[model samples]
Target: MKGLALFAVAFTGALLLYATGDFPDWGSLDSPANGGELSTHYIKEVRKETEVPNIVTAVLADYRGFDTMFETVVVFVAGIAIIAVLRDFGNGSRGYPPALANNLPEEPDLIVTQTCNLVIPVLQIFALYVLAHGHHSPGGGFQGGVMLGASYILIALANGVEAAMKILSERKILLMAATGILIYSGTGLVCLLLGENFLDYHVLSRILPTDPIMARSHAMLFVETGVAFTVTAVMFSIYANLATRGTLKGGL
Candidate 1:
């Protein structure tokens, strides 16, 4: 197994290194990716098409929404899978083997708790900022949701799994995850109901109180929010389940 793994790694690395020779030179204006017909079209048409100043956001949230939605589903599935696999069974206190469970400390560290009290709120605010700011600048749902989840993790580390659960319980996590997926999928269904293709945000203007271009922009925001909700909930759920063997009473 080790030999096969080593050979696979070496072959993959060699292939990648060989492929790099065909890549455009650093920051070359004439690079195929930067100067291609598609790139030129996107550069000229993105703002006019989506009304989103950030081209990356316009591409990911609007131009490529289908891919983004499925990727969110994949992340949510992985989180659920982690819970299914590592979850503990039988009646027992968790976070350690039965033999060690009785020896675990129940009290939280005061210093860590206090520090998190000062930091977590700010962190979550910043996460929301990132999620909302994506249309105009850097950062988006995935990045912001990870940041939001990390704040919860920090709380878990400072206090306990139970403490984290109090902020967002296991049942609520599942609900939020489902809700996010629903928001994403429902948006597509709405587009379909509007007599257009799935995820055709421009068609949303027929039902929405906005212009077609503005409708696309707002639809992208909703899509990003859906992504953020699923990402945040799934991320925290994975951590809680793995850290506490799915009991969610304590986390590392």
Candidate 2:
């Protein structure tokens, strides 16, 4: 059985390597991704069509909205799966194991706690800025959400998991995650109900005061906000579960 497994691994590895030989050379000017008609169209027309200064945001949130929506769903689903498998609702008071308990200090360091207290607020404020300004800049929902979630994780590390949970409780995490998905899906559903194809943001101009192009841009922000909410909730939930061995108790 061991020999058969080894053979299968080697054969698969060889096939994958051989297949890579057929791919275009790295960064070739004529490579499909670089020179394809679709790529050209996006580069030439994205800003004019969507009015979003950031081409990447316009593509992900407008031109390829369905794909990005599913990608967010994938992140949400992964968090849910980890929680379902590892969460221990009834064992909230169970502290860390003996090994971890011995290594950690009984009290959080004053300097570290103070520093985080100062830095965390600034960090979260910057996160909101990133999320709100993404269409016009380099940042976006995923990046902002990560920063927001890291604020909670920093609280956990500086204080304790329990301290962080006080701000973002388990119940809030689930609600925020579900609410993010709802916001994204609801936007598409509204479009559908308005007799436009799902996620067709141009149709939103009928309800919004903006013109068609601006409506698409504004709608993108809405969906991006939804993405940020889910990413923020899921990031903290995963850390809390892993750091606490699903009990969501005690420090890491």
Candidate 3:
């Protein structure tokens, strides 16, 4: 086993080193990507088209909205998959935490619990800031969602998974996950209803009385909100399941 692991690590390193030969030198202006027509197009037109200064955000939430919507669905599906496997569904409890393996209840750490009480609100605040500021800066739905998930995990670590569940029940988590995906795909459906291609943000202009371009930008923000909801719920769901080994009663 150790020998095979060593061989795998060495092979991976060798492959990475060999692949570096095709990569451009550090910050090389003449790199194929820098000079590519696609890159040039995005550089010149993305800001004007999306009205979002952050090029990556514009590309992800606008240019690739359909792809990103499905990507969010993937994240949602993953959470559901884990819940399906770990949750006890034999009885009426479809998604609730399973029973404890033993009778020994976990005691909370006073210091950790008190500190988390102080820190969780701050983390949640930062998460919302990141979600809302993605178009203007270097934060977005996935990043913000992870931060929110971390807050819940901190609570789980400080108190217990059951305590975290009390704050957000299993049903609520599932609801949030589904709701996020709904918001994403629903936006595209709405565009289709307005006589445009799926996810064509300009079609929203028929309803909003704004310029098509600006409407696209605003649509990106709504899409990002959906992403945030699903990502946050899924992250917490996975952690809760793994930390408590499906029971979600106790944790470190």
Best by lDDT: 2
TM-score of 1: 0.88
Ranking by lDDT: 2, 1, 3
Total backbone clashes of candidate 2, pairs 3 or more residues apart or in separate chains:
0
lDDT-wise, the better of 1 and 2 is 2
lDDT per residue (tens digit) for residues 1-252 in model 1: 999999999999999999999988899999888889988987899978988898988889888899999999999899788877776666554554655454657777788789999999999999999999999989898999899999988888888888889989988998998888899989998999999999999999998899999999999889889999999999888888877767776546
Q: Which residue ranges in model 1 land beyond 4 Å of their true spot?
A: 1-19, 89-105
Task: Give a tens-digit lDDT track for model 3, residues 1-252.
Answer: 999999999999999999999899999988998988888888899877888888888888878888898899899999989977876666754454447645654566678789999999999999999999998999998899889988988888788888899998999999999999999888889999999999888779888878988899888888988999999999999999987767676654
Residue 12 of model 2, lDDT score: 100
TM-score for all predictions? 0.88, 0.89, 0.87
- Name the better of 2 and 3 by TM-score: 2
Which residue runs of candidate 3 sit more than 4 Å off their true CA positions?
1-19, 88-105
Looking at model 2, report the run of 10 residues with the lowest lDDT sum. 91-100
What is the alpha-carbon lDDT of model 2 when measured against the actual structure?
Answer: 0.92
lDDT of 2 by residue, 41-140 (tens): 9989987899787999999889999998999999999999998878666755555555746587788999999999999999999999999999989988
lDDT against the true structure, per candidate, is: 0.88, 0.92, 0.87
